[model samples]
Target chain A: MGFLSEDAVATFVDVLVRLVETAGAVIIFSGCVIAFVRFLVLAVRERRVSSFTRVRLDLGRMLALGLEFQLASDVLRTAVAPTLREIAELAAVAAIRTALNFFLAREIREEREEIARDTAERDTAQRDTAQAAG
Target chain B: MTDAVRDVVALGVVAAGLLSGAAVALVTRAPLAGLQWLLDFLLAAGLLRLGATGTPTALATAAAIVAVRQVAGLGLRRARAALAVPAPEPPAPSP
Candidate 1:
């Protein structure tokens, strides 16, 4: 492709940043919506409130990923010619988002470990039962 | 660096970070603890470079984010470990 002019390049970067930010928001929102819908459907069909942890874990993972994108876009927004005040604002926003992402990640990890442990325990119990029956 | 070059590099880094995140999500079944750290490091480096070129904001932002993440992650890991440890059993009923 032909080279873009300086102004065009700057505008392109600005658009890209906005696009990424929007996409991040969409990902997070859609993740939550989808997870909720899935849970509702399951609950209705099964007549039980199962799979809550799975849904929450999936949603948390999506939110963490989306937050990463949002953070990147925020950083990119100041790439062209950022003023001191803008930088300060960016610092504040980035710090908050980073903290959110960190907690979301930790929660996701804990849930994953819990699920794994449950599965392992179940399998061990089943194996022992089968051996005793045999 | 010139504005065009800088913009290109910044865009490139962001793209790489996104791609890496996606790849990790797709390929890994485990929790993203380790890969997330790598992704954050890459982003911090990219933002630092952007800040060096007259955008001190990017550098400061990156530094603040990384610092918080590291400190919080340490505390979280310790807390998680503590939670995982089984509580000591109470002494047997009095004789």
Candidate 2:
């Protein structure tokens, strides 16, 4: 009859886990769709590598955030299952997701730098052209 | 419900990957960029799949994807350098 009874706790935890995981998936999918639309529009109008890079960068950021949510769900799962096997599974899943997110972060940083360089190059090229013409 | 959601996202990732890959190729005139874009989305799809399932086999496949992606990325960058492709910069020396 108590709110924190075993049945209530199990049901609450299950619902909580599902909610978190669903939120993560929604974030990732929405990010993908937004980036997809932006990429198409920008690709057509600008046809610039920097623009594409920017869109992809935004997508990567979203994916990283979503992964965090998913990893949180994995942790929640561990709370329910304290057995050795479950913990081992959690370790592996968490490790793989962590590694993926790390690489993703690195790639995002690299792309950001590339965008800066590209902008600089464009400015230099324009300046040179103007100087020659003037 | 979980399986359905995962399947849809997985399919969406594939479709996005192909479309974005082609778009990059067409816009940038660089096959390397296209391939890299494709691989990026592929990794996303893999991670999405892994979120629900954590079997040892799934973990191994995920790790393998990361390894392959890194190796292929390095190779592509090197190929760009060797072919004198105008990289935006010197890749910042991979920290």
Per-model C-alpha lDDT, please?
0.59, 0.79
Q: Tens digits of per-residue lDDT for model 2 on B1-95? A: 37667867877887998998988888889788788777777766766677665467866776687678777876876776678666366566766
Residues B1-95, model 1: lDDT tens digits: 34465445445544544554444344333234324433443433333343332455665665565566556656646775787699999999997
- DockQ score of each predicted structure, in the order shown: 0.04, 0.49
lDDT of 1 at A70: 77
Q: For each prediction, how big is the interface RMSD?
A: 13.9, 1.6
Point out the worst 10-residue segment of candidate 2 chain A by lDDT.
Answer: A47-56
Residue B9 in model 2: lDDT: 86
The positional error of residue A44 in candidate 2, measured at the CA in angstroms, is: 2.1
Which 10 consecutive positions of candidate 1 chain A have the poorest summed lDDT? A43-52
Tens digits of per-residue lDDT for model 1, A9-125: 779888888677666655655564565465446544543211445655676677677788878887887776447886776776677677767766876787799778877988999
TM-score of every model versus the real structure: 0.56, 0.84
Least accurate stretch of 10 residues (summed lDDT) in model 1 chain B? Answer: B44-53
TM-score of the first chain alone, every candidate: 0.83, 0.88
- Which pairs clash in the backbone of model 1? none
